[model samples]
Target: MFQGMPLAGAQAGGGIVSLIVPLVLMVAIFYFLMIRPQNKKQKQRNAMLNQLKKGDKIVTIGGLHGTIAEITDDVVVLRVNDVTKLTFDRNAISSAVSRETAVE
Candidate 1:
């Protein structure tokens, strides 16, 4: 009876360890596959937003396209046409279509 009890306890302990290893592996995979890529994309988006300047043609998240007419710390003015300019939060700009480069 004593030998049987020891064997059962050892088996239970090994079962718990086996379960723990797979659980840990799943968490690691989730972080690498999901969380890490999301964080990298967020950093790239922030860098793009910070580099925004006036005259850069941009597309908004809502699909509106225009040139940046004016910029402030938290606001952007988009010129859709000669008489149509719109104001939006800096974060509303999705991607810069083109950046105006200085002519040498």
Candidate 2:
């Protein structure tokens, strides 16, 4: 005869705590490992974009290198060569090249 039944209340509390603890740990790990670094990089990139000016040599995300010929609100004109100029969005620029590097 199977007449021994465990009370529901005792098991429910442990079950809830076990589920909640892992969910909280997962969120904390994701924030530190993934979200935090991505946000920091975005802030740095935004600062670089805002400081762009004429004669700053830069490389685009597409690997083109050029000097900033002009800057508008959201666009950039790049002089890749003496007669070759290209236009791109400000966000397309990756990083600025130093004057020494630009000369070489």
Candidate 3:
């Protein structure tokens, strides 16, 4: 038999709650510092993809630049040159460049 030992581990000052508070704060800090901005950027990218239309200039993930000649539910026809047209998935378009931005 153990003689005169603290009956519970919680006898340590600021037991479970003190241990848990810092962990919760760390998770919250990570959410704000890392996760939130990533989610916001992804939302902006999704919004841009949805707003794509014919005649919009886009850059593909592969770094190829083209003008959208046609659009469908899942495909885009990009005219890279007078004689070069390529079909790509809508997701392959990385970003769009407006005439104003492209000229600058």
Candidate 4:
């Protein structure tokens, strides 16, 4: 009697593929929008950290600004003032201020 109608128990329209396509698209969008840019920024930050040298003025994650006096594999000694120096982790550095950039 209902030959033209879909059965309630039928497998239905687009099966597993339909459900998966949107999910894959969502993951792709998330990676492109969020993950990829974040990874790129992290790599740039790592390169900047690796290039750190003595006398480079840097800002720390805590917003403290100082010039690098000494650096080891994992430690950074900042000369905050003539008699004030502080030690921090290399990773604690947020950004470095180049001499040219500082002059501007």
> Could you say which candidate leads in lDDT?
2
Per-residue lDDT, model 1, residue 37, is 100
Per-model TM-score on C-alpha atoms = 0.82, 0.89, 0.85, 0.85
Q: Which ten residues in a row have the lowest lDDT in candidate 4?
A: 8-17
Residues 7-60 of candidate 2: C-alpha lDDT, one tens digit per residue:
788699999999999999999999999999999999999999999999899999
Better of 1 and 2 by TM-score: 2
Of 2 and 3, the candidate ahead on lDDT is: 2
The C-alpha lDDT values of all candidates are 0.88, 0.93, 0.93, 0.92
- Positional deviation of residue 79's Cα in model 2 after best superposition, in angstroms: 0.4
Clashes of 4: 0
Per-residue alpha-carbon lDDT of model 3 for 1-104, expressed as tens digits?
77767668656566778889999999999999999999999999999999999999999999999999999989999999899999999999999998898742
What is the C-alpha lDDT profile of model 1 across 1-104, one tens digit per residue?
56545566658978999999999999999999999999999999999999998888888999998888999999999999899999999999888775454221
- Candidate 4: clashing pairs of residues: none
Candidate 4 structure quality by residue, lDDT tens digits, 1-104:
97898775565555666788999999999999999999999999999999999989999999998999999999999999899999999999999997887642
